[model samples]
Target chain A: MTRCRFWRLDRHPEGNTDFARFLSLQEEDCAPLADGEVRIATEWLSMDAGTRMWMSPRTDGYQPPLPLGSKMVGLVLGRVIESADAGYPVGALVRGFGQWADVATVVPALTGLEVVDETVADPRQHFGALGMNAWTAYVGVKEVASVKPGEWLVVSAAAGATGSLACQVGRNLGAKVVGIAGGADKCRYLTEEVGVDMAIDYRNEDVDARLAEVPGGVNAFFDNVGGPILDAVLGNMAHYGRVAVCGMVAGYDTDAPMPGPAKFDQVLMRRLRIEGFFIPDFLHRGAEFMPQLREWLDAGKLAVRFDETAGLENVLTAYERMLTGKNIGKVVVKL
Target chain B: MTRCRFWRLDRHPEGNTDFARFLSLQEEDCAPLADGEVRIATEWLSMDAGTRMWMSPRTDGYQPPLPLGSKMVGLVLGRVIESADAGYPVGALVRGFGQWADVATVVPALTGLEVVDETVADPRQHFGALGMNAWTAYVGVKEVASVKPGEWLVVSAAAGATGSLACQVGRNLGAKVVGIAGGADKCRYLTEEVGVDMAIDYRNEDVDARLAEVPGGVNAFFDNVGGPILDAVLGNMAHYGRVAVCGMVAGYDTDAPMPGPAKFDQVLMRRLRIEGFFIPDFLHRGAEFMPQLREWLDAGKLAVRFDETAGLENVLTAYERMLTGKNIGKVVVKL
Candidate 1:
């Protein structure tokens, strides 16, 4: 038996990801790998808004309530310590779905773990650039939206993990990219560092006014933060524009019921399409998405950034920081 | 010269479509029809929520307001008094893009005047069943939402022009149509007369409770009145549900600034697709839709209803009744 530490959602956080609500460290016995099972010691965990809705009561509480005293569900990088599964050899570095914990057990029934090499670049990018965030940005813009070169693209939270990747990827594909973030610093990072054509700090800038600068109008909008930002984007979308419903971190802790100014009118007026997707929804496309993303990263066509916190105890802090928009890139917890 | 009465957005109404505010009505000289021209003696006009949007001032105040004294745009039926265009001859009755006046002249380039026989069914249905309302309802459900037979289909404002048509069309297409209307009277008209599978008088019934009764959950939701009804539907939508954004009557009057609770999360959680569409946007399909609709009506497979108001001067009264939900089915002004 080996000691394994984990973090789980405590009660339901009211507004921000409540780090103080995290449970104290607990011990768990590592069971021997069962037939067709693999045992892994988690090295890194990715924190993002994609999993936020699963925590809400409205999601039919499908995902097990982040068990009161267990690690939260997230993506993690681990090394296979033991394997009863023939395909997964012991000592191979792999990534799979797990909690903010030090170790995870897996089987083929679940999405199989993929081995990644850290020496090539930062191993953490495997949890980011080559992982779900980048894949979401890639598949959403390229596949779901079927974005064409020369199309005008707008991305919300452009300084964040998925948005930054999407903007850079859109630019690489010959599409012009506009980024919207929270502050001047993040906006500057997006245009100057992430290589976006333009960046809008929504906090100070008017989205509609800035949109006019795009000439005709945005052909596609990759949204990460919903609410007013989504509304603004809808108002300026060109006829036949496509909107990929990325995330709605803006109203995560909101208790007030959302009312109707339901913007369906705009959707009709502009003949818009709003498609909601989670990376898992496109799991079947992994065979294609992974190889393509790997090439983009290896060729240095994509930029990767990550904010990592050491130890499982710091998981909740990382989550809080993410919700507060304190991190500029992907927020990950290192176990 | 012919006397014609037309309603303009005198000053966009605050809460209701005020007839007095419908700024213009006058006797105008008619020009002799040239090649490819058809002069129509207008007989019927339909009222809808879309007209309100065109009537109001743009928030940015950029585009000219739907020119203050121009004829309102809507579906209209008329008898051709003369035609220089070989396609339509004198005494031919048809329906097309006309106005609230007693007479209208249209160029062949823009006319979609479908010849109809009133003895077979009321010609008024040409503007209801085979007109913009029915076609809009059919396309919104069958095409954009891609509703499947045996799936749950819910429609808001289930008693109005488009709503009633959608309900019947959903039922005819093998869907269990659940309509959401404002009062018991409309609800009765929907289920008892219109053949909707079920009815929800949102004014008295609990939508969530009623939704729970429809065991299959909602596979497709054809939304007409957005806001709380839409929010409630979001929480109960089945996986891969499609929400057809037809109209949002809920937000037409409130003076509040337009920030609403974004159910953008709903789209992702259920893998939903919420698409908005304007009928004209799909005008290219009119060639196919109109013929198919006429065939359906001629075969007695579909039915249409209307609340008819006689006289062009009553246009304002008709518009008010439609806005207040006082009229069932299509509200048409007759000359």
Candidate 2:
């Protein structure tokens, strides 16, 4: 038997997640792997804002709420230590929904475990740029927004995981990408590192004013942070602009309902199309997208930024940091 | 030469149109028709909520603002009194954008005038069911929403010109239709006359609660009235639902900015797609839709309700009545 540590959801959060009170670290004994099962030693745990939404009492969403006393749900990249499954051999690196645990027993068929390619230069890239974030941005910009060349593409929360990748994707697709981020450093990183044409620091400048100055106005908006920022963007959208709503991170933690976009009339007046998407819906398109992403990665046309914390013990701290927009890119905990 | 009476925009309205103040009855002298020009004596003038939007001072939108001193823009069905154009012979009944006028000279090529079929029982039906209203409904329901059979469709302002047609179109496409109208009379007309599966009188019942009672929730929403009603429908939308935003009449008269949909998060949570479209954008599709519309009209599958006032001199009164929701169905001024 092996002792494994995992975080359990002790209670539903009222507003913002109170990690200490709502979640508890629990130790559980794991028996030897059964037939068609593999034991994984978790290495990297991805922290997502969506995790907070799952902690709410609401059951009427795209995903079901996490029941009380259950292991907190999350995605993990791990290496198989023991395997009774032929498909997942011992020492094979794999990625799947293993929750927040140091060790997890998974049946590849049940968990839909994916074996990571060993030849990839950086495995962490798979957790972000080559994984969910990049895939979401690709689907949004290419599939939903259908971003055209010379079109002004605006990305909200541009320093975050999905938004950062979306900026690069927009530029790669020949769009004039503008990034909206918090603080001076992140804005600088957006323009310099992410290679966006312009970066607006929401804390310092008026988003609507800056967007108004753009020559033709925003033709496509890839929104991650919803609320007032969405309204501001709506006011500046060009005629027939498209908005791909990837996430509404700004309102995720609020107990009170977030206000809707004030400039929503622009939706009718400008003939805009606002569509929301889930990453899981387009996972099948990965085969068509991954090769192009890999080529871009190999050719040095695309770059990824990782904001990693050293240990699983500090996952809560990292999560809080991510929620507050303290981290510049993908927030992950190394176990 | 013939004398023509028309409404000219004296100034832009501040809030709800003060028609008496901003619009003035002006008499103009019509010269003899030049080559390819036809002089039309107006019959029924269409009063649309969209006319108010053009009255605003804002120049940025899908259509340009109505300039001061120009005739107030509107659609009119008229008979050709005299014609220099061979295509539009004298005594032909035509429909085109002739502003609010009793007589006007138009070059058919420039104005895109269409000669109305003489076999039509009621010429008013052309304005309501077989013309722009029906076309708008068809494009929104079939082309934009792509409303599938057995799907639940919720239409706002469901007793209005476009909304009534949209409900019938949804039912015609084998969809389970629900209508949200303002009053009990309109609600009755929706269920009894329009043949909607359900009708909710927003003046009395809670739209969101009633929608929640529906088995699977709204799969497609055809919105003409936008504001609180749009928010309510958004809250009860099924996963991957589509909203075709044809108009936002609720906010069309407001002085201050109208509040957006409060339940907008459902757009992301339910993965909703909200797209705005104009009739002109899909005018090319009229060839595909008009034949089917004509068949439905002839087959008694579709019925039109005209809320008309006598004489073009009372056009402002009818326009005001349409704007205030006092008139149900298609509001037209009969000359």
What's the true lDDT of residue A74 in model 2?
Answer: 75
Candidate 1 per-residue C-alpha lDDT over B64-147 given as tens digits, one digit per residue, 9 for 90 to 100:
446766777666788888888777778888777766677777775664556665564587777777777888888988988788
lDDT of 2 by residue, A43-143 (tens): 99988777778887776656888889988877789999999988888899998767788997777765557787778888888777677778889999988
Every model: iRMSD: 4.3, 1.3
Candidate 1: global Cα-lDDT?
0.76
Give the TM-score between model 2's chain B and the true chain B: 0.95
State the DockQ, from 0 to 1, for candidate 1: 0.39
Error of 2 at B130 (Å): 1.6
Please list the residue runs of candidate 2 whose C-alpha ends up more than 4 Å from where it truly belongs after superposition: A14-18, A31-38, A82-89, A106-112, B11-18, B31-38, B82-90, B107-112
Off by over 4 Å in 1: A8-10, A32-36, A52-64, A115-122, A254-265, A309-317, A333-335, B2-9, B21-25, B31-37, B59-64, B84-89, B108-121, B253-264
lDDT (10s digit) by residue, model 2, range B1-335: 69989889998776554588888899978766778888899988998887788888766556888789998878889899999888888899998777798886787766558887889989998787788889999999987888999999999888989999999999999999999988989998988899999999999998889999878888999999888888888888889999999998887775456788888888888899999998666555666788899999999878878998998779888998888887778999988
Model 2 shows how many backbone clashes? 0
Chain B structural similarity (TM-score) per candidate: 0.89, 0.95
